[model samples]
Target chain A: MELENSGRESVLQIALLGGVYNNYLALEATLQDASQRGCDEIYCLGDLGAFGPYPDRVFPLLDQYNVTCVQGNYDDSIGNGLDNCQCGYTDPRDNHFAQLSFDYTLANTSSGNRAYLRQLPKEIRLERYGLEILLCHGSPRRINEFLWESATSTQFLEYLGKQHQADIIVGTHTGIKWLRQLADQRWFCNSGVVGRPENDGATNVWYTILDIQTGHHGSSKRRALENVSWRHVPIHYDYRRLACEMEQEAIPTEFIETIRSGWWTTCLEVLPGKERRRGRF
Target chain B: MTTPKVSLTHLDQLWFQVAGTLCNLTCHHCFISCSPKNDSFGFLSLDQVRKHLDDSLIAGVKEYYFTGGEPFLNAEFVDILCLTLEYGPATVLTNGTVLKEEWVERLRKAESLSQYGLEFRVSIDGFSPESNDPIRGNGTFGRAMDGVLRLVDAGFLPIITAARTWPMEQDAEILDRFVQMLRDSGYAQPRLKILPTLQMGAEEQRTHGYLDSERLTDEMLTDFDFSQLVCDHSRIVTDRGVHVCPILIESPDSRLGETLSAACDDFPLSHGACMTCYQFGAICSNPSGQAYRVKSDEHGT
Candidate 1:
């Protein structure tokens, strides 16, 4: 559905939605769908390389789609010549597979992808949307921070108040789609990773459509932020292919299964599986 | 009842740190500062909890609750709830990050099978990550909401709990925003609970522990109702043993005598958090819609 208030003014829109791993099948379909939905412009949310097998194929497609890309936590670490993924996600008690997956993300990121990643900004600000939309790999303040939609409004307001002025804020890192309105007149949204399926145990990539709709409520035309509509739409994608590609990439069976099942197995802390072996996490 | 050196109250509710010290994600403000490495507490095996069930029944306990670094992190969480439901109504406090469809299904099944009702309280610090991530870690906000959605899908409505880090005057404005956000995330009927932060555990170290002034004294009890505290009527069952109350489960003195029956003696509300309970009665008894009725008189009215 269209953003509620949009009657005529062009809606400022942006979406990476999901990471486009080499699973071109899902990527192609998702890109087609997103492009058709009247998105003002498409933004790619990071995780360009590492994990899935089709980096060669996927990179080209993203370029073809002309998606504006940001460097993910993984993209930055690998590009920096660091052996770690630098995901900033710490599970003190990781099981085996998680360790393997983290290591794999580090080992697999190619130099070409790394170089591209190193130049990526932690965030990009958009002024055209009539809103200060900051695009980043993670939270506006912290690249590794995970902003869940369930967080308290006060907490959201706390972070928003500290950052640059923006009517709407967007980030990726979390690989989940959620939109929240903060008390200090800011909107926070996360576009789930395309390369990685969101942890809902469902194989769906998510994105939001921000269509400009006219506001009928309190239309004094005095409220600078009045006439905008933002709608978050989550769509299902084929995780089976991503899982298959992950297995082929030697991304660890548990990681593949986690992606396939859309469920979180035990943390890397609780169950460290064979970092080199194929098994349950 | 003989009053010991400290005010003694009968156990009113049975609470357990079922998830132990393991959390799927670590938040900066966790009172216990639980994380992947912090197993200061261990998971409660099914057998350990079963033993306490018998003791609770014997002691005439009325309600039960399960909390942790993240309760859902426990492999046997579903099983634990299923079993606990047979004895008394149960509530599970969680970060709501790791809830998958399968787990939600299992919870729904357990709720339908048990005579007593089951409730879930999902904690979200800020309405979004910008507000939450600094406290809870990155990507946590999205994951937690996914957990809430799973609860809704399971046919169980969850109570959304938030710690008021903002000024008290901002409460109404903050709540309205929270309610709107919850509705957007598939929780049409959101139950909200706002709590003041406990300055102990990880929090104390994060900022400093209780100022010497924060502690409670005998004079503080002059107008206080002990019944307001969960310890008055509650007991906690853990792998080690059954404790006097949920609030005191972390304190060594609150451990009681181990088994639910043996732990029946009076408990001392010496912790600073106890003062908070004394001031704001029943902060944790499922605030509004209690799934099961517990006998409140044991803790003291």
Candidate 2:
């Protein structure tokens, strides 16, 4: 029943999180949830600060959980002392809020933490269970790209898979989770973000769990499709407390509204029509 | 003495002047001056589109866009879009006055069946008829709103694209009113795209054309991200030939070649419209594809 002809283990379970955005409570909840589910590995796909309060609180948790981290656009900005978050928002209102968050995060973050972020890799590549997995904050090509589920095409994903030589390409940054299966069992997964509720009317945030196992095709061929399953695991954390902290820190009230109502209040101008319509602005 | 040349980085967006220099409305700000009875450029047959679609796949085109005097004016517009949705995501830019319910219904079905998105960008200049009628035409705002509602009824969220005709200070107020108008018209979640008016074509007469001094010098692109320019990432396929970019289709120098492969040559930053693209990056793309502004320190390489 095992497809370990390559002289390696043929099963792996990994938990993937993107855009932490300083939501230490959600990160803690996600860590505990992943551990309880017997995840073999857990990874944070960058963006350690923004929106929420207490940027330093996230560092200790990452150390405790031994989560591998990749550099995100926010991380790059904070680490390099860049002028803005490079979130690609065009509206003046969106830019205003983004600047406030970026300035606050930069001012609050310790120099050590900024250095840690600077040293993080733009992409993390791993091979396990006969699958070549690539983890990145956005697409493999750009750090700030937004690959929204509705706007991105399967052919485009396939092109990414081919270009990167990845059987599974996982990314985040759009703050929503989605997955598409390409030909020959190739897959693209947006692990979503724990920073905020995905514009849906739900308080819980989401992460992705990929369970890769031996071939299930019941065939003798070694090239058979591997049993790769993806699940969007929702993490219910103390969002109300986070909202209070945001208010106390004098953060934009728009951000707090998103936390309380599970509807995005800012940085919405970049959303495509399909994705934008899914949310209550 | 040579103009700056921008090479094709990748054919990320492939455009079809499907309806050519033809449109239902003759808005004053129409950059290409697309209007009724202007058949300088002809509609691309479905066969022509099919050939280019096949060619685009090899070139690694990420998305497809259709435009015209009006794409829907072409009898095979729906068929062309349905076929394009099979290759990748497709966006159609229209005047919004001429849309049929049956076409929307069929297009909706096609979009649902495909993994790619089918975006309809409806062009209307102003929030009300009183404001829009002078620029777009008499009684045009109502028709466009009706088209938007029909699209909503068909479960399609069309992006309402408008050129910035009002004063720059009133942008926020204008956009807010536009959103409210769409909401009142049954599009509960209206998606809006605000475009900077290109001072070319009819716009040159309405407002003023680009000043003589408004040109990109070699020094201007030093630290500038040329990728922000649509010519760097996109090319349009027309019945005449493959053009450099959608905005410059009327220019004699805009035509690069007859084939996409032959059209990958570098383009000169010579035209006044190039200045518009330089000022506002990726004006033709949907908001999702628009380029980010370069940091202040990164400007003027």
Candidate 3:
């Protein structure tokens, strides 16, 4: 990711893709959509491989599109040749599936890809449209932090921003997209992943488009929250092809079901009640 | 001769002993020996809870947890939880014996309104009545299961928390039976959290107290992750005052101070309960608890 700080008055639209999880099909669709939408820059909040087929396929596309990236828990683990994904799942069943996914992604990820992931920054702070946006995976504080929409408190997000000295923080590791604004100025956003469906029982996946538009009339340094318009852009992708390739690669059918049906068949324990209630389990 | 004391790294979770020692059903394995008559500890009113909630603002409490002999035994339990939802995500640990329909309905609405999750961790000792009733009490399983059904029907996925008093090897079989039972009983997605049984109070007589060697030593802290210990990131507010943890509420030494900030002092892990916590990682916290780990070393993100 670019460390350069560029300030501008013009509308800055950036696409944030979170946790590809090796779904190259969705990655392709998301990139094309972002391009057609005239996204100024596309950033991927790490975890490049997991759940889907051919972990290496998504790398070339990411390179072709010039997507700036942040290191996720999976990327850190795979890059360092760690034993586990370090998602900190406690449930026996959740651990069982996490291990399988980790092993597959790590084993299949190319050594060069691992090297590329290892060099990626943990956080990317870029000043755009007078707003300092900090892009990270999981959270600014911890790599594997699961900031679920329901489980995370606004005050806590505020603490992360205050502690980290960022006006706006964008993170994704929970696989769900949510944004909470403080005084309509500072914000915390989870760029929904393109890895798989959001466990919302829909075939379509999602990525986020942060549309930082016209700031409120003020001599104050901070921009108004109303100026920061963001949306979870739903992307309809070739999920069937992804699932077929996943089956061909002998990926877990449980994961394949999540891609096809959009309900998470695994990693349900980590979800809080509100998030879990939204899914079919 | 020195007892290992764990530092309060951060105020991640704040527990309110809402109902105190008052409970409708006296489980054989209750750590506090809470019964209908056990008024040794007392209820914390909504007013008292609000005060602590105010105090928690300064502490930056990430989550709010409600527990007791049975939290619903308190008259203002639902109101307390509703108020807590405004601040952060709230979780209530219930015996699954006394959760009323009106309360669940109200809580469901409160949860939907709040951005945070309202988690209900229901205590069900066993998968079957025969196994569960002997420990929890006769006919207690039916009532708890009823409560579970009520929560499920209300679109709340309550995590069925069971005590692993049996051998570790049997956990898989027992959990499988639990999932199968919940599925058979119309709960399609059953969330289960297995807890290590604390050998203290009623359980001490029912089973046995911890051995002298079970205590944590400073040497043990060499490379141990302090975040795994609830005392490192949590404090429970009882009517008496703020206690170090839910498990050692009965122990006088567990009382840190009157306020959450005053209770920031490191706790001496002198009791047997701390051993159980040391063996298990953050058992008191919800499953989502593992997400907030202490940042890794120099390679930290």
Candidate 4:
């Protein structure tokens, strides 16, 4: 079930990541954690450049760590020389900040890295111990769609899984990580990003570790997921260092505040009430 | 010239005209012309809602919406909302005049128990009674503001939905006053949604009817994002049957079918209101669905 990103479908332990947003320090931290934890594969689900500082810093690490990348809305914008990041914010304030971040990331990213982004696949499929996994930037349908945990319904997630024919469908444009078990063994997950702290007033950004296992039923060896689970791993990177770098780069103080404090400052309008209320913004 | 047909790409939003053409207020701009005396449509019972919620799941409905002249007019509204939460997230459109503390509390409890959020889109026409009362009704501003505070006190962020009765240039000034009013009333995290006026039903009389030139032509839809139209992803379940959209329920041709699956078909964007939807997307949807703004040209489709 592998899509353009790779030829092989076989995978056991995966460190799923998303919303890189130019935070190379956190990306470095994530790579170290994934390697230390014996992850078989590392995937960065896109938005490789945004928010932090020195957009080109993210490219070398993706190459160095062998992280499979997918094209996110931000990546698509910068790659094709689009005006906005296509982050899908209608509010004037949200649009203003989004434009600023897009301009900065677009200006800073090198041509070589832009080529890499332009070539990334929109989605990737994986077969893990007989389970079909679909990895997308947002949902399986649209790139910039925000599938918030509260606003999104269980039936809808179930519908997405059935429509896409994947046992597990994971996306990460919202920057908030959550996992929900659908009917039967099917699951939907948001592999939260290391780009910034999840709006929850904590400096530790997050990622997901999807573990699949097989057990021997007496007298038979089957490739079913006897034990399949995912945990949102918090990556405690050197945010103070990242904050100083952002200051040096003259990134918006609003963004630097989100890096220092876990609460999101800009892009507040896009959030649903339940998600919005959780943030101090 | 033939009008462009909008196909049902997906049923992202499944709306219910729960209260039917009945409202506590007789807003002059009501597209459906619902009022206390008017009963062109009736209330939907809890059983009807239960059945539809199940059908919507099979139809791949992402979210559920309940609207009316004002949704709270129906006696079983709260019960209907509670049962809807069992299936998916629910958003109810209300005048904010007739909501009781008990209903709000129960809804708050139902929302807390479910993984899905319960959103209340309070239709407050203007910032003040001087502004809102003339449109919604006299003294409606006081009552709706009271309803807003009550929702805020009960830990609900009711999106203060106001229909734009004034000019576009007045948006900044109006929004400023609205934010100030909400914050002054102790709603700290105020969420606001502004809507464009649709010329139909009672509103057709208030404002002049759409000219023939205002209709959407087939060529206009070329390279146009069909997803911008609600009919592409949404259908309203009325007591009569499923309609193309919440705005076009009054049109005889808008009724697609009685069942959710049957309603998933192509529709003619021939009505004047279709032009309104073309101008403003996220019409009946919550803020989350507003990926693009009213000025669709601001962001590329």
- Among all windows of ten consecutive residues in candidate 1 chain B, which has the lowest summed lDDT? B290-299
Query: Per-residue lDDT tens digits of candidate 3, residues B85-197?
Result: 99999999999888788889999999888878899999999998998999989998899999999999999999999998789999888999999999999898899999998
Per-residue alpha-carbon lDDT of model 4 for A21-94, expressed as tens digits? 99999999999988887788999898998899999989889889899987888888888778888766656777
Per-prediction DockQ comes to 0.01, 0.37, 0.55, 0.39
lDDT of 3 at A168: 90
The sequence of per-residue lDDT tens digits that candidate 4 reaches over residues B34-131 is 99988999888888888889898787788899999788888998999999888888888888988899999999999999998988889988888899
Evaluate candidate 2 and give its CAPRI docking class based on DockQ. acceptable
Please provide, for model 1 over B22-86, each residue's C-alpha lDDT reduced to its tens digit, 9 standing for 90 to 100. 88776766777789888878988787778776766545454567898788778888888888867
List the pairs of residues colliding in candidate 2.
B22-B69, B23-B69, B222-B301, B223-B301
**Which 10-residue window of candidate 4 chain A scores lowest in summed lDDT?**
A1-10
Q: Which candidate is the best by DockQ?
A: 3
**TM-score of predicted structure 3:** 0.94
- List per-prediction Cα lDDT, in the order shown: 0.61, 0.86, 0.86, 0.85
- Report the Cα lDDT for residue B149, model 3: 97
lDDT of model 2 at position A211:
74
Q: Judged by DockQ cut-offs, is candidate 4 incorrect, acceptable, medium or high?
A: acceptable
Q: How close is candidate 2 to the true structure, as a TM-score?
A: 0.92
Q: Write out the backbone clash pairs for model 3.
A: A184-A225
Name the lDDT value of residue A229 in candidate 4: 63
